[model samples]
Target: MDITGAAAVVTGGASGIGAATVRMLAARGAKVVVADLNEAAGVALAREVGGSFVKVDVTSTEDLVAAVDEAESLGPVRVLVNSAGIGWAQRTVGRDGRYASAADLDAFKRVVAINLVGTYDAIRLAATAMSRTEPLDTGERGAIVNLSSVAAFDGQIGQAAYSASKGGVVGMTLPVARDLAAIGVRVNTVAPGLVDTPIYGEGEASEAFKANLAQGVLFPKRLGGPSEIASMIVEAVTNSYLNAETIRVDGGIRMQPK
Candidate 1:
């Protein structure tokens, strides 16, 4: 699909990979709506890209629906990027020496709700809107890109909830693509490795952990940048043939068991 003048919605656009996607899509002449919970950063990015900002909590259906409405006001949402996700570092059992408690269950539920269900919400709403647009030469009306992680496939210790949530994303791409095919909408995902995003803490990793990561990659020998991931997303949207696939942009890193 040609992105020029297309309306796009990028969730989690306030920072990190989402922020990079917003910038890249805007530069490609797509009118972007930066949907995020961080009001300040969302508005700032909106200004930077000459796009709109919709303060949205992906976990809240009301918030997501409202964001879709706001974005539709700008233009038809022909592109949807589900980049809002949270990372967790706790085991099913907690560091507090307790088994998975009610609080832990709640946290897991929240993560699944935000990362998986929330992504579906945006896709459903945006595809509905896109279906209303005239089809392009490739019979494509729109495209949706979801963010997964290498952890989805190669989950380490202490990543049960995070991995499960992202795995759900990876698993859904093909089915979602098939479901949307008749309407000329495509769905795909990107599974990134240790990215230079704040999802990891600011401090450098321990030498042991760094060495472990190094062993997984054949080259580049470092974390990926948000721009690199964004580039893949752009290609996924523009390349009509690239559908129902999860492209791993992880510098050949297949993570180790921690």
Candidate 2:
């Protein structure tokens, strides 16, 4: 897919990987819409990249539609990066009164809603919009990139909800790609491992916890940077043959079970 001069929409484009992707798409000459819940950051980033910002809550179908409409107003939404999501860590069941059954279930639903369902919404609507677009010389009308997590595969003890939501993302990639194939649209996912995103804010995760997390990385013993993950997203959009694949950008780090 040729992104230059294309209309692109990135959800969660206010921070972390989403923010990085917004910049990447803008730098590649794509007209970008930064959609996120954080108005200040979203608007600021849009200003930075000379793109537009749409305040959105991924769980809202209306918000998603509005975002798509905005992107189409710029032009057909040819590139969509579904990065708006939430994370939660709690075991499905626990001993010593550790488990909160109802709370856990609620958390699970919320995670899946935002990560899996939200991503699907973006892909479906964006593809529909892009369907109106004539295919380029490369036979591609659009590309969709969704974010997963290494936890989808390397799920830790307390990451049931997070992992399941992300796993749903990984599970749907191929089918979604096949569905969009005939329309000259592509869908893929990026499952990042231990990356230095805002999942742990400053002075949030303990120093020891951080060290332990990085210790598991097989090499380059550190967390991944947003730019590193963003680069792969750029590739997923630009590299024509790459579809329905969940590429792991972990540093050979197969996580340890807790």
Candidate 2 vs. true structure, TM-score: 0.94
Q: Residue by residue across 1-258, what tens digits does model 2's lDDT show?
A: 678888999999999999999999999999899999999999999999988999999889899889889898887678999988888877666565655543467778899899999999888888999999989998899999999999999899888888989999999999999999999998999999888875666674555667778988998898889999999999999999998899999989998887
Error of 2 at 101 (Å): 5.0
For residues 1-258, write the lDDT of model 1, one tens digit per residue. Answer: 788888899999889999999999998899899999999999999999999999899978788778777777877678999999987766665556655442477778888999989999888888888888888777788999999998999999878889999999999999999999999999999998877765555444654465555666767887788999999999998888899999999888877777
Residue 18's lDDT in candidate 2: 96
Model 1 error, position 56 (Å): 0.5
lDDT of each: 0.87, 0.89
TM-scores, all candidates, are 0.92, 0.94
**Model 2 misplacement above 4 A:** 96-103, 203-208
Worst lDDT run of 10 residues, candidate 2, spans 94-103
Tell me the deviation in Å of residue 202 in model 1. Answer: 4.4
